[model samples]
Target: MTRDTPHLWTEQKLDARYENLFGRAAGYLPENRAALDAWLDDFSRDVHERRARNAIVRHPSVADLARLIERDRIVRMYVSRMINEAHQRDCKNTVNDIPDLLDHLDCIVTSTPKYQGPTAFPMSALFTYLMMTTDGYAVFRDQGFNKALLGILREWCAHLDSKDSQEVLNQKNGWLSPAALADKKLNLQDFQINLQDPYGGFPSFNAFFHRELRKDKDVRPIDDPDDPRIIVSANDGKVVRIRRDIKRSDEFWAKGQRYSLYDMLDGSDLTDLFVGGDVFQSFLSGGDYHRWHAPVSGVVRSARVVEALMFTELEHTSGRDAGTESQVYGASVNTRGLVFIECPPPIGMVCVMPLGMTEISSVTLTVQPGDQVTKGQEMGYFSYGGSSMCLLFQKGAIEKFFPKDNTGDMEEGDPIKVNARIAQAVGDEA
Candidate 1:
């Protein structure tokens, strides 16, 4: 990932950003310096109590941030103010305060996410509020800060991949529990789960997360798998948007969040091929299938992961879903895996880009360069977290997008099954 100096924020810009975030909220304003100071005193005492009882060991990034805040009075005030603001906004049913946020982070190290509405991504919920602050805008964009944060996420991923993480596969408050299954809309019979083993014999949470579907045509049948001209959905997700006549570069961070081919492809040699092409974007929720598949039958030309920011979102967006709503912006900046497959003529080369958001930044690719892939073949999967995918087609490559026109009874934000036909090539007769 390229690193740049953090942008300097003037007082006017800072206040404007604050107003953009909290201007409509009806409560005590977090901008009050004295109120923030008092809240920090109470928060400090809470942190001390948590440490005394739980013997908490902070994530390295958190510890480093604490040290940094301790040395700088202005930054410390900003941190305290942001935390106070987050506590007030997120006090409904989730992590209500800083200590609770820290406790949830500790819990995530040992346990998997239980299916809760907004709290399914507790870290995101907290950060969504914090990221609206001026300090968060600068700190999250800093190279060194993001590096430390990525390190912490890697460690968490390691734990989730270990066998010890499978302890959460039980019936009581576990991922396999009835409540969780119902909430996630997961059907064990639809997947290749072991009916004999109590926990389906899965070794880890990551294993269960990307569980393979049973090879039943009715479940996820590929639409004309033998036809190279037909493109299928690469993953199970909701169609977010589709854009045509894309530019090489655009103001991706702007309110409309236009697609920028060069930045999205990470300056790849093939980036120019899609300059005036089309992009199909979709989103995967915490409950959706995490594995990615081939959108066309072809030879894999390039497959590699690109390093980028994990938690940063468009600063102008609001709501708990700000990070997710910034998918177009994320396509240019978030940690993602790009796979280029050279198909037959007319269809040309198709680029499948899987983007990671917030805690779901671990993208593991299973296919390598020069490998021949059939349509619907598994290529990679996101370990654990909210994710989205993008399929790029060269100029004039797509004749029609099925989902865009509500073909096959699909509409925007509707659940799309993997391997389902999503689009047709320019030369296709159908």
Candidate 2:
């Protein structure tokens, strides 16, 4: 296929596509229909029960807490086993594609001769059912489960860091192959990438993804350094959503989506500071630059890595391709690296969050707490795969934003580059 362009399918097209995929499962495997329907019904009830409990004024009984703990323990074990099995298969069977393994769970369609088309992931009704189910929620919330997943990711990172991984990445069929790299439209001359052996360089795919640009090149902070009034885009991605005067906990703008400061901040003490803040959500495409840059010059107050579920796309219930559009309220659920930056004067504390998606959720932090960072400086990056980043500002810090051609629509926004001016600060207090 030619280099992929952004294909914005109309709502009718999306509906038709989903209906066809849903019909394939329903028609070819009629036996699974009843079970899928029954699971959806159960999930709806679980959601109702969850909301009912949230409305209850009294604290949960000790028995209820104990039962929840037991359930969590069981789910944690199951999730751990699932990760191990998947990792083993990928490493031993050379089955790099994960969606291909979903067939074993009887949750997705399988092919007789190793399928090669783009993986239609997170489209399975069973996958959606699993995410909404009580067990799935428990597995998601349990730190142990997340930690286990992280452990595997770190090990994989170690391997990728080795010379062997670099060799693989430089091979014809590797991630950096001409065919695969074509989609990115990468121009080596435009970037500060090392040309030591132009034809076969790039220490690894990780290095290529996080490659820095030349000092005299395209990306840089606006000329006015003394002005605290300017805020720049932290990464190269399309704006998905922007919200102002956010509540402590309320439904996200996306339909049927809900999130709270506690969940977004991983229940840190910093959560309260952002109860009534402004949030800007944007996501990277598969071929977009992967490194994260500092959005403002500030003191790093605190930086924490939060453990969360991977491949948990919130907008899946809306019958959209996972990771293709805004993930609605997924920032709260995906494993993320959080940084609280205390912007000088006019712009106060701001939060920069980099969330992981799919199997490439490993975050490598380049800076730590107490460090002073300048705008456009690297903060961190995802090892592989497209991910999302969020910017949370204190209420009123950003007086007004000129999101280029942004109309506040979820589908598309003006293409942004790191260090490019995106918003301006106000003189008034939030």
Q: Against the true structure, whose lDDT is highest?
A: 1
lDDT of 2 by residue, 1-430 (tens): 1211223334354344343232222121112334444543443354345445663222222223333435676753644444443333221221122222222221111111011112212123333323333344446556654554445445445545555446444436544456544544454444554434632567664566566666686554453455668788888877756667777776543554344667788877888777677778777755567789898998999998886766443433444332233354667777788999998777888999997765453777888999999987889887754477889988767788777433433334566777777788888433
Residue pairs whose backbone atoms clash in candidate 1: none
The reply for model 1, stretches above 4 Å from the true place, is: 1-50, 58-81, 84-107, 115-118, 180-184, 216-218, 318-325, 405-412, 428-430
The reply for model 2, stretches above 4 Å from the true place, is 1-147, 171-189, 195-200, 219-226, 251-259, 319-326, 404-411, 428-430
| Leading candidate by TM-score | 1
> How big is the positional error of residue 28 in model 1, measured in Å on the Cα after superposition?
27
TM-score of each: 0.79, 0.65
In angstroms, give how far residue 428 of model 1 lies from its true place: 4.2
Q: What are the per-residue Cα lDDT tens digits for candidate 1 across 1-430?
A: 2221224344354444434322111111233323333443444455567667876666765566555656767655655655655444432222344455555455445545543322344345445446755556666766665765676677777777888778777766677666765653565556777646777779887888888887663667888977877899999877767889999989898866489998999999999999899999887766677898999989999999997887776765644334334677889998899999998899999999999877874899999999999998999999877677999999988989987521221123556889999998977453
